[model samples]
Target: MLTFTNMRRVARRAVLFCLGGMILTACSGKHEGAARYRTNCGICHHGGEGMKGEIPPLIGRIDLIAATAEGRHYLADVLLNGLNGPLDIRGVHYNFSMPSFRNRLSDHEIASILTYLAARGDSARPPVFTAEEIAALRAHPLPPSAVADERRRLDGIHRLP
Candidate 1:
């Protein structure tokens, strides 16, 4: 027969084992999400000549966006609903709008993409956009009129090739 002390020890070990398993599962999920971001968003957002003034560079911009609350909000909204019109980042203007991925990606996937971008991009401070924030952006939606206005504004600055 086991003593009370031994029973407590066994229970403690079981708890620890369960916690370890949970941690490993969470880590695996993150790894998979990172891979998905590379396969999807990395195609256009990662690196390259960037369509010659169309798509913005993802790297290094993360810090820039984190510097201001409005910038952070805009970044989250753009990722959730896609951006339309002219976007001026680091002095260069991207005249084309990005398509929304709401139908294709889950909230967690979107959060992972944002997390990757925030970590790897060119911002001075990386900003993480929460899944809740993304869901909220999706709920509100960007107005078509606003998108059209941005498109026209961008057209005035540069022609998309």
Candidate 2:
């Protein structure tokens, strides 16, 4: 035989436990995109600001780079065909080359990664990359060197600073 007050307390505890579990799930859910991004590009981007702008961190720069049409294309091309040689990103020069991920990742995966990168950037209004757009770029695949050339042209056209 249980008292009414004890039953109420037990019920309250159960509700509280359920709420806590829900909150944890929601928090983990929010990081799903971050996880996907980490799997694809985090190795280079480092998933944090520790690199101090050395490896061309994408968290806060993707929005600015993708603001223009050419910028968008350059970004996609970079992913599709890698970027070779030295290039300046956010005024910092990084010589290490990025290998082509065209074969490693699908176009849809590319779009998802880009969208994740853009959303993680410093822009409040991040641009979304669609699978169709990535497919279009993939149709005309370019070499890494050509991608670098395109980046140079686009950089001149869309100067961030």
Candidate 3:
């Protein structure tokens, strides 16, 4: 009792529904931080690895430096005021410069970016990075030299809070 046209229409509807479902499923799995990180940080981090050693890799190693509150502050400072000069990352000294995003990105965006990084490096729950924390550093943004100095300080004190 069914016409061929009706059968074709039904088949097309089923196919369209399946396609829509697949698209929705794929989109639902993407993380907000991961997306923003990809847009902003990924250009350099490249999924946590600096391409061809031009930038130091941050994958799986952030926990060592970010274990304490001081370390966290150091990180926020670096993000707020870009880092320049030589850095010894896991024995390999990288002298590449990281530009500051203080002017370009808001404190919240920076926090979101860091949150993504924390999740990546720790594989645990994201750190509680508040805007107040970012604002505290806003009063006097450090230069890359100062950031490097802080890095040295971390090395000296063993990065304790």
Candidate 4:
């Protein structure tokens, strides 16, 4: 015993609700990378801000380093193997050991984290790290000191960011 107008009103409301939910899901997908980063890297890096001069901020640093091909590989290697020893970044010296996640996280997870950082940076065209790229770097494992050495070499070559 329902009127046709009443049924149309209910259908319109349902459609609107469905559309709203779709929009929310699309927005959430954009931040999926950030969520992944929070779970894996936010503990120490603190959402790329880092712990002042001790941990090194990734906001400006990561994007700049990733501008070059070699720097991109260095980042993947660091994530896969880890980094240690004294490191100087933006005139700040940090001596700490970053744990390796080679066994803990997959290539896609690592790529997502790096890609998220790159997107956060102020770059005209930010580079995206693919799972394939991460896999290639993962093939070669290095000690923490070696990673540090690579950083030094990269810094010397490009002056870093």
Candidate number of the best TM-score: 4
Candidate 3 error regions (>4 Å):
1-30, 123-126, 159-161
The TM-score values for the models, in the order shown, are: 0.64, 0.74, 0.73, 0.81
Candidate 3 accuracy as lDDT? 0.75
Q: Which candidate has the top score in lDDT? A: 4
lDDT for residue 103 in candidate 2, whole number 0-100: 91
Task: In model 1, state the lDDT of residue 5.
Answer: 98
For candidate 3, the per-residue lDDT at 4 reads: 100
TM-score of 4: 0.81
Which pairs of residues clash in candidate 2, taking residues 3 or more apart in a chain or in different chains?
Answer: 59-121
Ranking by lDDT: 4, 2, 3, 1
lDDT of 4 at 98: 92
lDDT tens digits, residues 13-47, model 2? 99999999999974554465467667867877777
- Residue 159 of model 1 has an lDDT of 31
Which one wins by TM-score: 1 or 3?
A: 3
Better of 1 and 3 by lDDT: 3
- List runs of model 4 lying over 4 Å from the truth: 1-29
Per-residue lDDT of 1-161 in model 4, one digit per residue for the tens? Answer: 78999999999999999999999974564477788889988988897889866887889777788999999999998889999999887788888789999998999889888888888899987788999999988989999899999999988887987
lDDT of 1 by residue, 35-98 (tens): 8777777778654235548677766655455455555555656666676666665567677667
